[model samples]
Target: MEENIDIEQLRIPEALTGPEAADFLRVVEISRLVRMHTWGNDELAYTAGELLAQCHDPYEWNVMLIARVNGVIEGCAGIAMPLDDNTELAHVTLDVLPQAEGRGMGRKLLEAAEQFVRGENRKSVLVETNHAASALAAAANEAEQIHPTSGTGYLPLSSREARFAFSAGYELERVERFSSCAIPLDEALIAQNMEATHAPHRSKYRVHQWLDACPDRWAGDIARLEQCLDRGQSPGHGDWDIAKLREAEEFSALTGRRTIVTAAECVADDALIGFTSISILNHRQDVAFQDETFVELEHKGKGVGLRIKEANMTKVMREFPEVRTIYTWNAPGNSQLLEVNAQLGFISAGITAQWRKDFNAY
Candidate 1:
């Protein structure tokens, strides 16, 4: 039986509760399809369960809109606020089912998302899309730039998606390369050596690994983590405080699929020094994904960074023996961390470019 998509019945909702699981599943399935279509690869496709887990995170304020025709979900859009920083940029991710395309549903969803951001008094909104969506490109180009609010589009690489951003009035701002280095976990002596080198400065600090929940003792460490993250390369955004960092921790605990391995100071210090965490994403039973690793500026130059990483990698190998390959990403300019990983036997896999444009002028 063919269900009719009633554009008029579609509505945007603030939150998804337990009762809406079925509808949310449909939305996620549609979203996965859209992502796969846009990226031309299934490797990036996230399942409905994964989306649900992600949405459960408390740190991100995720909004979902459902386009329904007679109560059947035909399309959906979502937005997330990272770090819960009021001054930081908010991101939007949207998708319409194949049957609902070309019917102006996507435009409606975008408008709803924009209104939500405006209501929050946010400074800007960002979205990532591939080159395949011509209509999305056109919509971005035609989007109005309200005073104090602008839209920018970026292309990571030259593709059908890059052209879309160009047509939408987005310009390339910077190209960030995402590279991964992997090392075999069989070298315990190397790990111990790395730990020993970083031990003098790391003496007062301790490393904690969390598998199922967020640790309470690391609250201060979380705050310091945010500070370090600020120093790292990201799309320009405002700073984060303790409250926001807590929210981020809660969110990761709820949403992240990897083991959260954190190293932090055992005693509080006024200098805001000592801490790092590496999220290991277990994609396949045997593959580990090193999504991010960070250390504070004051703690730099010491072996603290490398020691924490070595400890985390050692833990992952011990706990998840099935994991054969570990993947990681680094900004193009981070030579220090890059050199450390190189010493540990991580080889460059590939590069992903970061592109951006200021939408304020659009």
Candidate 2:
């Protein structure tokens, strides 16, 4: 018998506990299951609380479409569009239960999401696939390879997600190395890294550390650094300012997460030269994500990146001792940052390929 699958857009309630909470929670559970099945672990799964915050976040618009088989939830697709910037791009994530494959549930949800984004007049859709590092080389010789437009990295064409995106008219955009480092790192290792990267010229710069909220004095400079990072990701995009920074920090706190930030400042003029940050789930401290590390172009080769990253790691140990692992993503072409991460004990765990479908081109 062909199963009957019904898809509907989920209404995110103001409070988590309501008539709609059950479906929302099921979607969160499905996300956990999908990550576990895909990566052999659920480290990247978001908690229900976190999902609620994301839905309520003011700077971004998010919607979830759920697929139910005979009144039971089985799959979901999420579309996230940035209201602050990248307004023309929608990020889509689709997940279906292991037993529900090949029954058209994923396809239905994806189609629905595509229709919704198109209705909103989005210019492009972005999707990502994660592959285990150990298995990549095994099929490198046997399977076809797909390289991103950057031409710097490749993913096996045999991967299911890659094939799905390719068939759907998406093009490979970039490949990023996913890495993790065991934390509560040896104090000696941290000390050694700090000393090795230290320079006399570095004495002109001082490191500052803070929690979730930015100090009013450095707000403007921090916004500038954030804009720098944003421009690096998407050129010709604008509107990253102090207001957006506050909105982001407020959303992070509302998501039951805490952020630890380390920033470098020039002593001569008191300008921020660079900054780095790590975000941890307050309820689940075993793992965290290394958010952003950016340094001004003029200060790139002065060991600013390493100094901020190392100082941030030391703070992570002092503040969140339960953080056993810290994970980060880097472009394959960014050898300098990768080398800094390597020195900090990070190792490649997997690779994630970013795909994009430009509606006008397609």
Candidate 3:
């Protein structure tokens, strides 16, 4: 919408197979980095081939766009349409160089992404924005940041991304806090925590871990656990659907991701009760992510979550020695897991707010 700014659709390989995908992947990698920069974490990056697999993934078809002003790719956008469930919903994301902020570039890129999503007959679209809470909360909007809704919410209106989303009539649906811990691979500290965690639950459960795929023994029970991930979540989300459920097939589609899953099994029954996973790409091993860490409802207070996380983080310490820090997200309402993360030395790093805009409502 702004002069000198041009948003053009960038076509990834129509048939994203074979050597020709290499050229397409290079562009994708560049675009993904532009988005990652807004996270303010340099160690966060995606490999060209990994992102290539994502672009042409079978579970969902993703659309990419590049925004330029004077012929420089300063921003990019991605639109995804799911094939399994929630077909009426589209997910869109716009990323711009930090230096390129405040020039109406993000709003322009978002508009371009929305136009593409609308073309697919989507009824609703979801987007997420991340801002450093401490940084912004301290700057100004402290009171507004303390509030939960858009007019005054966790996301600072002073932020460029927040301004664009709120001005565009996007509703703040959910606010999630991002936390991180610097891992020195301190064996004694980890051992102490694991010992204390095992003190109460040792007689009932034992810890086990796997490299990538979820083991056959744990798959079914884990599926049951995953189903309740957002069961009693806070209300800011739009029309709920079964689409958020993670299935085994989805894991297979993430061929480029390496998942380190740690679980606690009942010693007597061999049922998987608690589990945590840290997934990362092999090419970018300096950083890893906390995928999912859940303990079954009945077994929650028995320290299962703590032991599993400790075991998995300890595994990262032993195996991936180069990894400096691990990042994880939790809702402000999730006091249980938040306490676990705090005990694990994960301080608040940033907050990512999920916002939704309904095309049909308006």
Name the candidate that leads on TM-score: 2
Using lDDT as the measure, the top candidate is: 2
What root-mean-square deviation over C-alphas does model 2 reach? 2.2
Clashes of 3: 0
Selected candidate, larger lDDT, 2 vs 3: 2
Q: What local distance difference test score does each model get?
A: 0.57, 0.86, 0.73
- Ranked by TM-score, top first: 2, 3, 1
Q: Can you write out model 2's per-residue Cα lDDT over 84-158, one digit (the tens) per residue? A: 667899999998998888888877888888889999999988887778887786777855888899748888878
Cα lDDT tens digits, model 3, 98-205, are 677778888888888888888889888889877875566565634444345532236666676677778887888777888888886466767767677766567899
Give lDDT for model 2: 0.86
Residue clash pairs of candidate 1: 5-69, 6-69, 130-161, 131-160, 131-161, 151-359, 176-354, 286-322, 286-323
| True-structure RMSD, every candidate | 7.7, 2.2, 4.3
Candidate 3, residue 327: Cα displacement in angstroms equals: 1.3
